[model samples]
Target: MVPIPLASEPLRIGLLGCGQIAQAHAAALRFLADDGVARVSAVADPDPEGIRRVAGIVGDLERSYSDGRELIDDPTVDAVAVVAPTRFHRDLIAAVASAGKPLFTEKPLAPDFSTVCEIADTVRAAGIPAQVGFQSRFHPIVRQLQDWVVEGELGAPMAYTIRDDQFWPTGAVVPGHSSWRAERSQAGGGALLEHSIHSCDIACWLFGPVARVFASTRHVFGFDVEDVAAITIEHHSGVVGNLVTVFNGVRDREERRIEVFFERAAVEATTDFIIGAPEDSLLLKQDGAPAERFDVDALRRATFAADGFDPNREVFVYQYFGYAAFASALRRGLDPVPGIADAVRAHEVVEAAYQSARTKGAANVADLRSR
Candidate 1:
């Protein structure tokens, strides 16, 4: 593996893809650059236009390559971020791991569970620090919900309901950048994998590992992949929840809401996945007490402070926080949270849900993991 970078040295990050998501990482890296945490030193993408777009955001990159492998092999790149398509993740991850560079990859590690396992094994064998993009985990309201669950501040957890709806990527929402998301071979699955995989991860993070799942799906957009999926999950902790994910025709609107019910309390949170959370984003009620509202900005500042970051200097977007955390972990020579192992666990639940949909019965998550 590459020598662990000291905390004082800024990590030189090489980005493997310069698509839409890559732009977000570039912007985040730009923010981190001011703090001497990291900088976008190199970028690779087949599209010259994409490369140009990201270079504009990061400003003065050391190098840009048309081939991702060249960027991976570049001596000056201290780490690599894989923002490629889901179908390309396996090979890119293997290349980055083999290069002995730390990796930060976007979510749903791969389209299939077995390939996700293969990627995890490759990263483990290489002894590289790796993190997957489950960015919502970095949101302060979500962190507060986790604390409430873990500290038993809300008695025993009972159930949860999470609904995530977005305008279909292949539709007018994202334009030219999102066509691959509609293809089954490229995206692996439909709404379940490309989108709600975050919901699966969040469900497991908030409650515990999923025990079993029963699911049903629909092809509202008539793509080869299902655009709508409804899943019922039973957590190992005895918490049960229903998740509904849809890729619809809603223009300029992306909605996400998470409501968890406890034995004595209830918690609800709402936010735009593209933008950040709105004011009064969190609501809590315990027993006979009135519901309490929380300012999401204040909660976010407190969360950043607890993590030893200056809230005023940090970007408020949830995606930026994940990249920041990854950069911090790289500086400290430590593995980041929501790592590949965590991705595998979340994928296991998703794969089980798919299996249940196929067989029209509950599928055991442990059974999928055993193989």
Candidate 2:
């Protein structure tokens, strides 16, 4: 088995956006920098305030620009992070590809299917390392669940269910809310793309490539896009799954969970990358036994037992592993986990879901596989 690569020397990371997600990425980079992982060399955002805000957190930014093109073109930058809004992802990705820099982009690849494929094609042709911000995949619980399932501890693959019902960002207030995410032309879709895309990617990662997608979405909150969606999927591994993403729920709590049922056993995981959540547990159950629960703390202890585990470690430390993983992949000249191909495939699934919502029928994932 190949060992996971670890970053060495200096990795100068260039951030392409300073929006909300950029703040999180910058925070992660700060943690990674302590371990000699990477440093934020420069940043770019259209808004002057965006750059100022992120610079406040990242600190020591060598250069700042309002246009992402100028940042990508800078010779001092080693890698790029496309944390801009989805609408700008395609062009930024193309620019980074043209510059031959490894990239890490926030999810949904783009606002539409064709552009997502186009960006992925460009990145693939560039032959540079890339990773997407499917941060949940880096969660230790998720990794353990996937490993156990693949090792047959979950028995033969049967079926799975994914749900990401969040409260905020319902888009009921459109122009009053985060405008880019509320508009169909800007966001592509609502709940499915924004909230459940993570679960969608996880489903395919744990199961197999998606074969077909059937979905129905509604503008429950009168947003320019759908606020609620129910998507059914068929996997090429002969497994079937359903994904439910309802962003308009009138509730105070957020729920993100996925359950995979196998022939003789089952595993269920909840929430996401953010560490130290109350419900962030992974449970497993066999045919006639009781369910076993696993959480971030337990996983951390077990993983570092030989290294003298420290239970009081900062939760943000675990979060930085994803950034380190991306740097390591680039350093080792390996394909990053949840890379461009994965993003493109997940984007295709979401696109097919939109098509299914329109035709009221199952749509083949292959239909949008190219453009």
Q: Pick the candidate with the highest TM-score.
A: 1
Q: Mind giving the per-residue lDDT tens digits that candidate 1 earns over 1-371? A: 34485423578889999988898889888877877778899999999999999999998888999999999999888889999888999999999998888899998798888898899999999999998989878777778888998999779889999999888887434657567787778788988888888988888888889899999999977788888999999999899999999988877767789998998998988866643444238899889999998877787778878977786654745666787788777766678888988898889888998899999999998798677
Over 70-124, each residue of candidate 2 has an lDDT whose tens digit, in order, gives 8998877888898988998888888898887788888889888888878888988
Among residues 3 or more apart in sequence or in different chains, the pairs in candidate 2 whose N, CA or C atoms overlap within 3 Å are: none
The 0-to-1 C-alpha lDDT of every candidate, in the order given, reads 0.85, 0.78
The TM-score that candidate 2 achieves is 0.91
Q: Number of the top candidate by lDDT?
A: 1
Model 1, stretches more than 4 Å misplaced?
A: 1-3, 6-8, 171-174, 314-316
Residue runs of model 2 more than 4 Å from their true location after superposition: 1-8, 170-177, 249-252, 301-312, 317-319
- Each candidate's TM vs. the true structure? 0.95, 0.91
